[model samples]
Target chain A: MTQRLKTPLKEDDISSLKAGDEIILSGIIYGARDAAHKRIIESINSNQKLPFELKGSVIFYVGPSPVPPGRKSGAVGPTTSARMDSLTEPLLKKGLMGIIGKGDRNNHLRKLMQKYKCIYFIAPGGISAFLASKIKDIKEIAYNDLGPEAVFEIEVKDFPLFVAYDIQGNNIFELALRRE
Target chain B: MKIIKITKIKNQIKKLIKTASFNLPEDITDSIRQACSAEKNNTAKKILELILKNSEIAAKKKIPLCQDCGNVYIDIKIGENICIEKFSFLQDMADEAVAEAYKENYLRKSIVSDPLFDRINTKDNTPAYLSIVPADTLDGLEINVFLKGGGSENCSFLYMLTPSDSADAIISKVLDAVRQNVTKSCPPVIIGIGIGATSSKVTELARKAAFRNLKIRNADDKYKILENSILEKINNTGIGPAGLGGMTTALAVNIEYMPCHMATLPVAVSFACHSLRRASSKILLP
Candidate 1:
């Protein structure tokens, strides 16, 4: 059965989620990709303040297209999550609660999610237009110079996602492989 | 000889890029439809349905099918009887056309100035990967455009196998590649296998095969059978749509082969995700 959850997710909320559980997410989530992740890490290294609140937050790894005329968003789908595996620890260290992207991540990340009580959600890759329809609004929050890779606060309604990894260390990919 | 203006070619390239970004060719759509119907896993079926819906929305609204907009690959086949005005400037013309199309179409500019250091956005997607082929037997010019997404491109593989390797060896290698990479590349993907040739040439062959029309099978019966067998193995892995789990791991497997050195057998595997954005046009003359 599908469940609905709000952003800035808490431990209590995500702990109950098991791998392969479908969910709909509403509320504000942060949009960031490779470049933005690098800069965010640099800021942390330099002891500079983070651009956005990190506690109880979820980051969607995306570099959305230029918003077209008369539209709130352009094609906005998840990018591959594994690319961000090495850079994810700092965010999770600072209370980042969730990540949304496509594909399975490294085993280290799955363990980290379990350690931090975090969750990994997978959005269908390349279904950009239908995914865009879920976005209510988007505002650039930081790193505007990164262009499409800039961090943005995206307000979404009923954004569809699947639980790929949960707090208990269950992984949907492994489960799926076994089922097959 | 017929003379075609450079401006005409550039404009045509621009139009094809825009068309490809928004509309998927019918062969791709039809394959996805078939996969959707054949899918048994509910999650996989639902994902396939959403993919079809996304295609519809993208075409109807003239929005890009994916945010990557993709790095552009253009193949121009020129007939022996055709000559281009300012033929030396063909690459420049194609690059300009890409810049203009990406800007006016509201597509994302994903190209960077450098690969490793000082990675700066080029602002306009330029310097399209363009190739010119001599179509000696043809009567007119044909141009094909493929927009290859970054996610799928990352999944491409190249292997140097012993000359004595069997077909089963190649199939097993491809299966291993797909099993490891398909989740990130987006399945049900089309697998393109290139065997023989030098390493670089084999990779090029694989990319070309990946973008070939899905409706067309390899001309050689042996390669066609190999393609089918590989497809069956990949599907049996049950990677499913979007790699969540299901029966439809791949839509098609296209094999393009050439004679290779007696000492080495080079194999390359390329992937085209379900989107499979490509378009073609021809210039006819009287």
Candidate 2:
């Protein structure tokens, strides 16, 4: 029998997600990629408050295309999560519960996720159109000059994703790719 | 000879970029449809269906086929007899086209100014990887544009093998490379193999091989035969869609070959993920 997660996940709720589990994530997710991550980390190191609280938050590693006429954003899809590995530990320490991105995370990051009870979810790469449908709205929160790389608070409802890395440090990518 | 205005060429290139990004090319879509029907595993079949559906959504709604619109690669084959007033100004015109397309079309500006340090976004996707080839004919130009996404591009590998390396060894190395890099490169990949060439030529041939429509067969009989065999072996790995473990890990394997030094066997593997956004145009300059 398959397990279904309750919607609007809390910090403790992250523990329920496991590698290979399918999830329909709802609520708020902040968008950040490389440039935005560096800024966020700088703010953290400087003992300044982050633009949004990290507690129970899910950060999507995406740099979206510009919004077309009559659209909120264009072609928003997960980028490689491993690019953000350097910035993840601090954010996880601050109570980030989940990350949504494509590709693998390193073992050290997986260990941090385990220690912090966070989950790493993957949306289908290159399925930008499908992924964009799940996004309800987006509001630029900071670094507006960064264009597509700006930080935005995104609202989503039932955004489908699969858990690639779970709270127990199990990585579905590693498990699935291991040579028999 | 009438001189073609740089601005006019720029506009056409911009339109091409937008059209190529918004529309999933028919050949690639058809290939996915065939792969979906032929895929044996239930899970892999479902994933292929989703990919097809995603392509539909991208076309109907005019969304970018993928978030990574990729660095613009424009291969220009200029006619031998055609004359340009300012021959060297072509690159500037192409850069302007890239900027306009990336901005006006809502495409992501993915290019960076420097590779090692100060990794700053160029804001507009300028500095296209432009290659100029002299055309054999007298009256027309041919332009081939490919939006090469980094995910699949990163998975590419080059191997310098001894002449003694058997077909089996080549196949094994290619499979192992894909298997090792599966999660990193988005799955349901199209593998392009270039065999029997110098290192640089192998790399070029691998990319050229990837641009061949999945439905087409290599004219060379040996290469066509090897393409099918390699495709079968890759799918047999069961990496599946998105590396979730299924039978349809590879959609196709296209191979291009060139004569190499007798003692050296260079093989290059290039990967194209499911999106595969590429197109070509031929312009008649009368």
Chain B, per-candidate TM-score:
0.98, 0.93
- Which candidate number has the best lDDT? 1
Tens-digit per-residue lDDT, A1-180, candidate 1 = 699999878878987899999999999999999999999999988889898998999999998898888999888999989899999998888899989999888888888888977899999898998888999998888988777889989999999999999888888888988898
Give the top-scoring candidate (TM-score): 1
Single out the weakest 10-residue window by summed lDDT for candidate 2 chain B.
Answer: B1-10
The segments of candidate 2 whose C-alpha lies over 4 angstroms from its true place after superposition are: A1-8, A174-180, B1-5, B40-42, B137-139
Instruction: List each model's interface RMSD.
Output: 0.9, 2.3
lDDT of 2 at B111: 80
Which residue pairs collide, candidate 1? none
Return the TM-score for chain B, candidate 2: 0.93
lDDT of model 1 at position A21: 95
Residue runs of model 1 more than 4 Å from their true location after superposition = none
Return the lDDT, model 2, position B54. 80
The all-Cα superposition gives candidate 2 an RMSD in Å to the true structure of 2.5
Question: TM-score, each model?
Answer: 0.98, 0.92
